[model samples]
Target: MNTKIDFSHLGDRVVYVKPVAVADLPQEVQAQAEGLDELFAVHNADGVQLALVADRRMAFLLARQHDMSPMTVH
Candidate 1:
């Protein structure tokens, strides 16, 4: 299985989408989870979080809207 991905065209406009447990987040963020067990976090290459969205699809959509390439993190 060749899973090679070329991200050269994206340059620095790349973001990561990963699932986050509500319980692992701060109280303030957890409160905003709306009773959901999980959420998706969008982060930059430097490991800085850019946004916390309600779902994985939304996280990817956000990145694309901003002209960024979104990669899923396990």
Candidate 2:
């Protein structure tokens, strides 16, 4: 599931990986999450969400792939 993504626009920054309940997400987002109760969110230093992934490992891998440092929020 490693789709090519362009991350050159986002300068190098520390990103945070946090867990989020699927039920708490918007209806459209939750609808796409089949059989998933939880997901991981990658946020920038400004607290802006950059991506939502299926697991913590994916979240970290995504950030690293984009040249960003990843840290666990909890």
Candidate 3:
């Protein structure tokens, strides 16, 4: 079963930062997560995941590193 959904309507050249669950992450990452549930995900305007980091600040830092301005998706 295909599990991808589209978000092209949100436009382009933008990044969204949102919280993520450790359980939803990979096993290796979960191991490194150290019982952390405060992870964040940085995604493009199209909803393609870019970076997954350990906090709100890191999410924005990741986006800036990629030459993008991060917006908190609350």
Ranking by lDDT: 1, 2, 3
Q: Candidate 1 lDDT, tens digit per residue, 1-74?
A: 98997888888998999999999999999998999999999999999999999999999999999999999999
Per residue, candidate 2 scores C-alpha lDDT tens digits across 4-27 of: 966556556779999999999999
**Highest lDDT among the candidates is held by which one?**
1
TM-scores of the models, in the order given:
0.90, 0.82, 0.72
List the pairs of residues colliding in candidate 3: none
Per-residue error for 3 in candidate 2, Å, reads 38
Candidate number with the higher lDDT (1 or 3): 1
lDDT of 2 at 51: 98
Model 1 residue 12 lDDT? 97
**By the TM-score metric, which is better: model 2 or model 3?**
2
Model 2: how far is 33 from its true place, Å? 0.5
